[model samples]
Target: MSAIASSTRVLVIGGGPAGATASTLLARNGFDVTLIEKEIFPRYHIGETLLVSVQPIINLLGAREKADAMQFQKKAGVLWQWGGEEWTFDWTKLNCDFTSSFHVKRERFDEMLLRHAQSQGVKVHEGVSISEIHFKGDRPVSADWHEEGSGEAGRIEFDYLIDTSGRAGIMANKYLKSRRFLKAFQNVAVWAYWKGGKRPETGFEGPLTLVSVPDGWIWYIPIEEDVHSVGLVCHSEAFKESKTKESVEELYQRNLAASPLIADLLKPADKVSAMYVERDYSYSSDRLAGPGYFLSGDAGCFIDPLLSSGVHLAMHSGTMAAACLASVMRGEVSEERATRFYHKCYRAHFVRWAVMVSTFYDVNNKKETAFWRAQTLSKEDLQGAEWTDLKPAFSTLMSGLIDMRDAQDSDLLSQTKSRLDTVLQQIRDNHPAPNDRFYRNGEEKFDWGRRPENAIDGLYCTYEPKLGLVDTGPTERAFAAVESSPAAE
Candidate 1:
């Protein structure tokens, strides 16, 4: 073997949840893993609300105890505001392992994950940026990078390269040249942090609140130390046309004021940070792996933030990438086969998420404006397509369920599913008739239309965090063409 290939060295770019997770899992599996991050730790990031789906992933990483120690606000469930009414549901309804997930401060949460990776024997260096990844033949040989503030340059070789680069898509943009943005959720966000913001009733950390308006929706997430992270989401049209001559900050404040509930919550708080702008909320990379490299999380694709799926996707993708790469390193899986698996699972989750995002917008009944109008995925909106199963069916995926079941957790998952189904049936028996205003098909109308997309009669929830391998519900429900039917696994 060449000197570079002699060591099972892995270098992960970006220290976000995905990168930290991938490196940690890789190192735990006995691979020599290193992580490169551009920024120092404890940096600010959005996506503070976590779904119940991340419980096992955290437990798998041995951070369940660590997370429990951190004392983040406990989220009993989600509290959503739609059509002038509010309802709350607990994770017990889904048989989640934890009584509650967390409402985290991303800066602290990410740092914890990175530090946990460091604890697992993964080499980590921050304040260093990768200038370029040099390739030999089709495989990456080395990466050229330097310290953030210094001119001193350095180069390092690796046996495999993993990109958990988040939305930057360092490898996807620099090497593969394959990223396509989805117009359906093509949107931007205006947000800021506020100290002394309102909290949910004292017993729980969340009921992470989502309030939808005519232009778009607003998120009210309680983070650390009695602070709340608030944001507004809008498509490009609403961002530009709705704002007109207003600056981004004004737009943010204006939109915040426009919503009565959010306005009431923020009225007593003080803005702790400048209003921020984030554009292009949705996109997908065409490929996940090439030659000696792999992509995970936002490196591969980004879905809308409505579901708070960003962190889960990142960490899940990273862990999955680590597993796939580890399989090849152990000679347990061929790279050809592994790459195919990565691509399939990565894209599957992305497509499923995209469909979910579309349905979030589809639930808007108040306005027929361009902004809200574009969120629906009707046959005309899909351009002559037929998708049967976009309707929400269960709450399992809200926590970011993967399609595949892990062998180790098979028994536990079975028990969880059985209990979850029991609760689901109880709800089904009491579920009121479908609301006529939103009922297009024979589908049962849910609050926010949030349910399982392809809920198995009792078995269809996605299990693993990495592979989007969802059960197709019997064999007949799988979709083949996306432009036509996007409702399959």
Candidate 2:
């Protein structure tokens, strides 16, 4: 054991949003935190868009003024083009009016966050790799560390460990194994940044634009000035057919030609970053944490990015993990209790988002083509309570409550619930339920109209899966009960 100490204040791996945010928060609280990152700052990252909900967290970190000074892209809200409709919602209408949603240049944004954390007294180590985690049970007291370019090995022991490693890392992969492959979101995304890309006219500027075609959708996000983040997220099958021996750049051009909307945008743009494609990119986790180890951000889970839930969920988890770790440090709760509480919080928010995303795969909405049809109808088996209650309402509202193409009005709330309720009833009416993992108490409620008490519950719905369903009177009551409860036992 290299430099084995009796206890460590907190050891955080990965310097992305979750790791950076957690370290910043904990350091601000006067804790000894060491944050390790393999990649150097100003590195390129794909997810550059943020939701309006992040305003509060940004405000908490006091980054609002600085971000504004940097001239970040301001957004009114998300304009989603899906299910044959183009709908827009001003998230400012959802109480995040102080700041606009952002289209960030990740190179700048991530560097800013890391620098901000350092300014707040966080101990940040860059260009270091944590080779392996060595723990006695769930309390990871030591981690083997090494310099990226050298053969030297070292170790540091800590009392608490936070795995914010983003995407299947440490606590999430080895301990919690929380990553779950939700069949509904079976797609691949090829993303690259382009300089001198199309910029919309003033007042028409938006951070996120969803251009939906038959098989899948393409996300067009403009970041910084003249540099836009473009990615094509398509069903796996659609992607394979277009695969060729050509370079990613060539494939990018060919793929863009598949959709006129994307083609028009790329006509004048030049690729600024290498094109990378990630398959089976959608996943959830088995749990968020246990004992001395906790998972945060993408380390815990990542729902489909269709709604741009990526950054928001990661930020939410980072905040939640920091609080849980603090509780353990203060002796206010046992490590086991803290883990359970964190897990509950993690699931509450994500479950709702997952269900909502799955609805896009529902082919029954009358799209033209077998590919779109199979993608949508394939989601029929997704009729669990989380799918029924929360998805319909979320999708209905997120999709503008009605397709912008025509005036055929439908009560999005009632229609969604009726369809969801029918599915729930059918599952309940069946002889043998598929599995309890996919099911939750139908009695619970969720108030999407308002943010929930804790970031985890408010974001994932991992604890009371029912909390992801329905936003209104019942959800309000349900949220109160869960919030009032003493941290999970």
Candidate 3:
């Protein structure tokens, strides 16, 4: 890589984690970056839990200290009560450097990242919405904007665009029209906050507890020692059918009452917030990037939240987009190669997660139920194939061991296999019948990285000195020191 031109203009939409992460990294690399958000800072949002994979990206963004200072509840792993079995997926048992994550209040967490982006010299505008994206041929060249309640509006011209506008899917929905909802994951989520919920006595401390019900599932997250966030997920059709009989509040309560574990945990708790309902269905775009634009975060794809992958994917995509754009602007790689890398790597990660989540649903004890059967993978679903085809990738993703650098064919498989073998050996040396899903899944060899479909134009993500795409073999250093500018300061 070479020094990026200080005159390179990059426009980022949405000030959520994805936008913030991309803006900060692009600014750090000396690009003239501007970010616009439709909402004000500290706005209320959902998806509070995070995965350990986020730690590396946070470090790359230089926001580790700020995140740790928030004192969010530390999550070591997850506890699951599914398939008539109870097990804990402990991160400490995995062969990874970082062994923990956090459960955060999205308002505070998102605000911190956005403010950090501004501090890094990214010109940020709050309450500014992008009304329309202007395109010359197939490339987006500018955007029409307006400030909420301020009567201020203008158009921003940029050499590149990063759409992190979340579920709004400004590019995928309004412009490209490529968003497709996954029918198998059509779900509705109802959640609310509680005060003084009883903490579980078992599993890892500050763990996320997921309990399966006859129809759906419940998530118990410890946002604070006393403040907890509880949510229920049910099939969209089931929710629609029940809504005719009762309000969302009544339906949520009914489900809670039916689940003895969650009901018992909240027995002494009081509802501290209004009920919130969201269509939790999963969706993806047919394409993630084009001529001069890239779609990041929910703008690209959103998978089931069963694994708490929302923030991780957002930050991951943001980092990938920044690296791709920087690589192109610095003349280190062609625009086509960079964009293709971004699309393939980001989409593969999303599909891997989608497959993993759908498979988990199929294996649940309630697979016979209509709610579960609809989502379950059947032999006739896709040429009589089984979900275990990608079990190795699923296990790696579930353990939070995958990263951007591992996006393409490289040393990822060898590394994952060595680590997984060690973990499996320890399991066999100790417990003869290890019931932990992590251990069970670890026994399989990691071959996803070896698959030919993962590589893009024979390029892969690398970060020897800084993040950028690199050729397969026998080449000069692809990335070098990036020149500093006012933005880098």
Best by TM-score: 3
Residues 1-489 of candidate 2: C-alpha lDDT, one tens digit per residue: 122233358998988888888888788767898887888887877787887556656665667787677678887665555555454554444322343568887788888888898898878878777878887865678888876765566788888888888875766667555566666667788888778777543244564677766546678888767777888776776667656555556656665677676677778888877777887466667667776787888887777777777887777678767766765676655667668656664664566556545554452357665345544313443322232223221221222222211222334434444554455455446525332222233321223322343232233222121112111123667666645544321
After superposing all C-alphas onto the true structure, candidate 1 shows an RMSD in angstroms of 10.4
Q: In model 1, what lDDT does residue 248 have?
A: 84
lDDT of 1: 0.66
**Residue pairs in clash, model 3:** 1-478, 1-479, 1-480
Tens digit per residue, CA lDDT, model 1, 211-272: 88766888888777678888888878878886678888877777788888888888789998
Worst 10 residues of 3 by lDDT: 480-489
For model 3, residues 465-486, the per-residue Cα lDDT tens digits are 5656554433322211111111
Evaluate all candidate structures by whole-model CA lDDT and list the values in order.
Answer: 0.66, 0.62, 0.74
The runs of at least 3 residues in candidate 1 whose Cα sits more than 4 Å from the true structure, single-residue gaps closed, are 1-8, 200-204, 377-489
